[model samples]
Target: MDRSLRNLAVALVVGAMAPLFDSTIVSVALHSLAADLHAPVATIQWVSTGYLLALGVTVPVVGWLQRRVGGRRLWMAALVVFLVGSVLCSLAWSAPSLVAFRVLQGIGAGAMLPLLTTLLMQAAGGRDLGRLMAVVSLPTALGPILGPVVGGLILGAASWRWLFWVNVPFAVAGLLLAWYLIPADGPRTKARLDVVGLVLLSPAVVGLLYGLSGVGGSGGFSRTAVWLPIAVGVALLVAFTLWALRHRGAALVDVHLLRHRPLAASASLLFLTGASLYGAMLLLPLSFQELRGTDALGAGLLLVPQGVGALLSRTLAGRLNDRFGARVVAVVAFAVLGAATVPFALMGPGTPVWVVVVVLLVRGVGLGAVIIPLMAVGFVGLERDEIPHASIITRIAMQVGGAVGVAVLAVVLQRGVAAVGPVAGFQQSFWWAAGLTGASVLLSLVLPGRPRVAAPATPEEAREPVAA
Candidate 1:
């Protein structure tokens, strides 16, 4: 809210844009990339899959990295790594090379994502979180609006290489701003890496994510590739949970934090949010292209109204969350989201464009309204030291939940198409997505209501200096 916290947010948001933009932008270019590199679509898919898996492996390790290195240094260092990865990706000549480079980029992103929340929450000293998250959500709001459109335009005008080149400006600008704007952190803690926990958790995340990723391509969860890794991931996750319970505060993730009711509820709701948001994303663009015969660019252009709706709702949603608390806002938001999604389920091949666009706008508003409260509530009563672990917990929940949503919907879409027709199949999937969102409305009832006035900053928080 104050000048220093605002500046820190600006710096982090600028840096965060690289990954957020990179993911969506690169997705639009996958077909172009497959053709350019002379690779099969299946092989080229790794360019995205490898990055996601690498990201999953690295996320659980970030809380440890931040404690060891300090936030400012860790953030800037991760930015540098991402910058380098971007440059390498631009030069990649083969599919394998590109996938490897993306893995490097993912490692940098995994650290930055959660660390961004940890730094801002720490600096705010538990004050004005709803307002701060609005600022934090800016690139998130902008990414959907801009990333696909920008990718489409770039591919139209230039070679696919320009896609990677686009990140150069954002990364460079982010680095320069961070150097002067972000307050330097104090001495680092001597927290030891939980090697055993990392061994269990990181692989568990990769297996789960990788396994889920295969479900759609392999036709169903019945395939060995689809189920084997997932089974292993689930088993390892159970082992890690037991391990973390024993270690308590010292574990890689601190599974103990789930005992905090607000956090527990927020984490669960966040999983549903991830499912609704990403599952729909996969469906929307494809629906336009497949059923409406829109090209990638046209489909992207048609989706702009949704992005605009999300952007418009963000600030107001934050204010409402601050005033009425997460419970009321989230319940209404999810209800709106579910309601908007229903029209899509009923849409026919002859459905009017204006009708679809209007629904998307309403859907986007629901999307924007739901995020602020869920993101902020988990930290409400947490101690400063606990913030990093909480960040890790929420981020992982969202990521894993997203994978699950996408995988399940993909399978559903495939079977629906096989059993019914194409148009009918898509309708079935939309119904499923709407149902998942409706479930979130019920879950939101448990979120904390009418937030208390922020407690006074601790002596340590007060003493932490910032630039005037």
Candidate 2:
């Protein structure tokens, strides 16, 4: 990529670090939040849940928003929203207020997530996509590695309020860089919003996320709180699918894009990869805490090897995707991920810490490798207009897949603990995660093999705001 594109990536990724880092940091501080705010853990859980639901509600609207206000303006505005929300969260006097502010933060985050990918992919114009995704995905790779460690250090030194305060620098730097570096808005389009599609899809995603989050507390899917909303979410999702199909290109997310083989395969594989990654995440810390008797910080430290491994593999994975194609890279990634997970399944409390660390390091490499291919492959043959929709679709697929994975694994872990014991329960959960990874390996075969070179965009196409 050129200097301009590189700068754009740097600006966007820097801004994105606030939300991504904020997520893992806040996760580590939940218990502290509960105690400090004098709220029940269940109530404090809303701090995360409310933000996630807001993200679900807002993510589907981004394509429309981007068309309305261009990527650059939309990005700055979202960053500002997140910045204000973070400050408000730091100042929060009560649990309800904190959760409310976090929802605001989520609104910003929801827009930023898809927009980040949309902007980068559009700027790159389908060239060097593998390399582009590696740079774009930096925050993701770092969040798991640095977020917890940073959170541990901050909480150890100061008040829980600093958690939100930490976001200010990233957000501010992102905004300043964005204003100076990102291209100005292009000519606006008058594309009409599909209100009907929005009405169906927004709630559909929120319901799915909320319902799935309830699984751990409800102790399986049998509870009304768990199944009822999920059923409604599924029903609405089906309705939106039918509506999107009928609406064709004008729909909120354009279900017709699934006709593209690369996107279709990528979307499907992303779902499974999401399941594999997030499912193990849910199980891993809990296993460390329960089996090894580590606290939250120690567990966080233990998982750093995985994140380091992932980080180390980013550039290499991008090169491999460009050279060998997503199929070869992904198949091997999933295989490695599955293999690494096996040690966890077999381990007892007596397993050496070094062994666990080594396995996580290898597992992180596999995890790192999985994202670049899945994220970039879908955009292989998409048009500029189609790129935004593809971004939304792939993002939603991974998100819903993550919720499903977390819910399913939580249920498995819960049941296994009841039926067998903690060690065995964790074993069962890890095995299930491995099984999902194995499935991903099989699905990887369907991805596009080795990318062909992209032609340069025409001057007129390059000047268009949407293309930019």
Candidate 3:
């Protein structure tokens, strides 16, 4: 990569890392936060839940906001907002206060997630999307691995509040880099804000996520608390879909992009990937903590092999996708993921730690391979103008799917633990996770066939860049 491209890559990766870090960091600190604030575990859980709900609620608005305010300005502004929220969260006096502040952080974070991809792709001018996405996605691979370790270290040496405080340097650096590195806005068109769509979609997302979250809580699925909001949310979302279809070209998400085979397939695979990846995420830590009697730090450290495997595979995965296409790589990767999960299903309290680590390492390689190519494939055969819309749709799908995965796994774990105990519960969850991975393998079959190599850009074509 050229220096400018390298700088842009660095900026995007650093910018993207903040939210991933926060997600993991907060997980390890949940118990500490609850104890310190004298809050029940149930209530303290909202610190993470609220953040996720807010992310789901706000993500849909990124494309519209980018068009309205310009990507660079919005990115920098979001960094500032996140920094402020992070500082406030560090000083929060109670669980509710912290949750509220986390929502603020989430609003900033939600925008950052989609914008990171959109902006980087825009900057790259579609020259080497597979490679760029791999670099951009490195943080996601690292976050699960490093987050808990960082959180644990802070908890051991400092206070839980430092977890929030730690985000400051990253956010500040991201803001500075974005202002300097990211290109200024191109010519603007007078695009109308999808206020109606936003109004309808935000609550729909929040309600669905809130309802799903309640599934594993005391109310369970049949309770009014669990079903009511989800039902309402689904109704609103369906209405929004109809409304968006009617609006078509003018819709916030541009539902027409679904007609693009590559984008659609990519989104579907993302859903399944989210189901498997995050479902396993929930099970893995709980298995170690609850069944194996590992503490937060130990559980976090044990996951390092997976991260290492992911990091090791990313460059090779990206290069292979560029050579062989997303379809082949994704299918094989998902299959590998499913195979890796089989070991977890068979694991017991007495299972050797080395065996567990080896399984995680294999699982990590599969995960690393899946994410980068799956993300890049969404833009295949898409026009430059359509990239942002595709980005938004895929992002929302992944986030919502992740929420579903977490909920489904939570329910599975709860029931499995109740009936058979923690070890069996984790094993059952892993089986379910393996199933989801298998579904992703099926979904990957629909992705576009081997990508045809583009002819090299001529001097004039290189000089006259296409707008993202």
For candidate 1, lDDT tens digit of each residue in 122-226?
999877888889889877766855688889999999998889889888899999999999888854689888989999999999999999989888558999998
Q: Model 2: which residue pairs collide?
A: none
- Per-residue CA lDDT of model 2 for 301-375, tens digit only, reads 999999889999989999888887888888898899999999899999999999999999999999998899999
Q: Candidate 3 overall Cα lDDT vs. reference?
A: 0.83
Model 3 CA lDDT for position 320: 81
Worst 10 residues of 3 by lDDT: 459-468
Runs of candidate 3 with Cα error greater than 4 angstroms are 454-468
Over 99-132, each residue of candidate 3 has an lDDT whose tens digit, in order, gives 9999999999999898888887766665666787
How well does each candidate superpose onto the true structure, as a TM-score? 0.96, 0.96, 0.94
Order of the predicted models by lDDT, top scorer first:
2, 1, 3
TM-score of 1: 0.96
lDDT of 3 at 194: 84
